[model samples]
Target: MSETSDAAKAAQSVEAEYASAEQPPALDTDAEDVGLMAVPATAAGLPATAQGHFAVVNANGTLARGFGVVSSSRLALGQYQVIFIQPVTRSAYTATIGLTGSVGASPPGEIAVVGRAGNANGVFVQTWNSAGAPADRAFHLHVSS
Candidate 1:
């Protein structure tokens, strides 16, 4: 009886192994880049015909997924570019970029931007200026990079 149970378990294990072997190997979702978020900043001091800029404050040096907007009310996934224009406002609200992956852990490293701005816990800021204040703009993060 005990031998029969052991055989059954062995058979099940073999079946699972076969099933997995038949399918393509799973991707390495454990990669540090996955889901990312972006927020809007102000466009103050820029000329009426000027475009603003965007900035990111990465406190933990995590690799953000991506950045963009949603047309619908649902918080669905969307893709945003690395640049945008912002409204003319005095105060600016720094956006937060969150990173998620397989283990869902933030990568331990310094922050960098398009071959510039390399520092830990620093702000990756991009702006369009018309003189005194900068124009408002939107931006997205790069993860697969």
Candidate 2:
């Protein structure tokens, strides 16, 4: 048989097989599959620590968007302070180098997070280049307790 005719026969076979295939149980797969995922019925058995606050800060320490964040400040160069509406002194602090927008990858750097010395609601963040010198870099902060 000619190549064109042979290709046409294969295409028709595929079409017939697909037409005989069964449809999934649901049309909206994401919504239907969500019910199959394991979700805790309650938080009673989980660890006490839970994400309570988060913030995305610009290199200049401007608040981008966040939950329970009051304000953000660029203290000096790579140092920043993020304040939340509630006290977070006892919460676990975490930070990572990031950008205020999702357009590009953030500069590779090191970040550290800690509770502010005198402010119960403040978190201290510091970013440093790979060489360890402080440098201005946007970051994301998370607080859990």
Candidate 3:
């Protein structure tokens, strides 16, 4: 038992098992259900829970949910309307509206429905054959479920 005192008692039992090791639990940002969950404004149809920009598809087999709105200002053409904080629960019938970013002219296909079907929010835009009647736009409206 004297090989340098048995290697100093096996290095003090491996430093007491690395000082009793046992740590991993330090992240409790005040814990009380921590964040984002209050979706209720008449929650209905395919993932409708009252937020914004949503999509939950699986069509042919059922289960669909897609709601949206992305907007920009400045228009001078015939129609250009908007609205939709969160309102697209039932009848949207594959709704869609387009035109995006830096588009100055000649970019406004069409989409003029989804105004109140089962409580939609709003929509309407123009331009397609109107060529480039009035510019400055960026719109994207969507609906499903």
Candidate 4:
């Protein structure tokens, strides 16, 4: 067959398989703005951590996008576009939990959190030790609730 005809046949085959598939792949939650996307747990389970090229601010109790951890002591990053989607209430507090990367590609890294803005008026962005450690650690946090 001609190249064009061959390619058309392959495309049709792919489409047929997709149409008959049970479900699509679950999207990576860590890559979306907080309010714009709501990612439920997949077969792998809910995103236990956010791991991406972007920094994510997971609201308290909400899973961090893009990254997750096999254990609390370590984390892996993912890719997500993060933003402050909603504002907290007067009686509520906003917490910023940050997970830092390892030194020279090592595991068993460190994490830091900063809580500030009077429980309802703070914004945060994640940082790393290369940014400068606050108290001799790889990460630091300032929180006020």
What's the count of clashing pairs in each model shown? Answer: 10, 0, 0, 21
For candidate 1, which ten residues in a row score worst on lDDT?
69-78
Error of 1 at 121 (Å): 23
- Alpha carbon deviation, residue 50, candidate 2 (Å): 4.4
For each candidate in turn, give its C-alpha RMSD to the true structure in angstroms.
Answer: 19.1, 8.6, 15.3, 16.9
Off by over 4 Å in 4: 28-145
* Cα-based lDDT at residue 46, candidate 2: 43
List, residue by residue over 1-145, the lDDT tens digit for candidate 2: 8999999999999999989998766668778888787465445554344546799999998999999899999999899999999889878888888888979988999999889889999999999998999999999898887
Worst 10 residues of 3 by lDDT: 54-63
lDDT tens per residue, model 3, 1-145: 6899999999999999888977656567635444445333453543344344533212111113334643322234434444445554443533333333234443444433345433345444443333544433333444443
For all candidates in order, the CA lDDT equals: 0.34, 0.88, 0.42, 0.35
Clashes of 3: 0
Error of 1 at 105 (Å): 0.6
Q: Tens digits of per-residue lDDT for model 4 on 1-145?
A: 8999999999999999989988866567744566466556556674543221222333222233322211111122311112232332222222233434333432222344332244333233233344344222222222222
Better of 1 and 3 by TM-score: 3
The TM-scores, one per candidate, come to: 0.18, 0.65, 0.23, 0.20
lDDT score of model 1? Answer: 0.34
Best by lDDT: 2
What is the Cα-based lDDT of residue 86 in candidate 2? 87
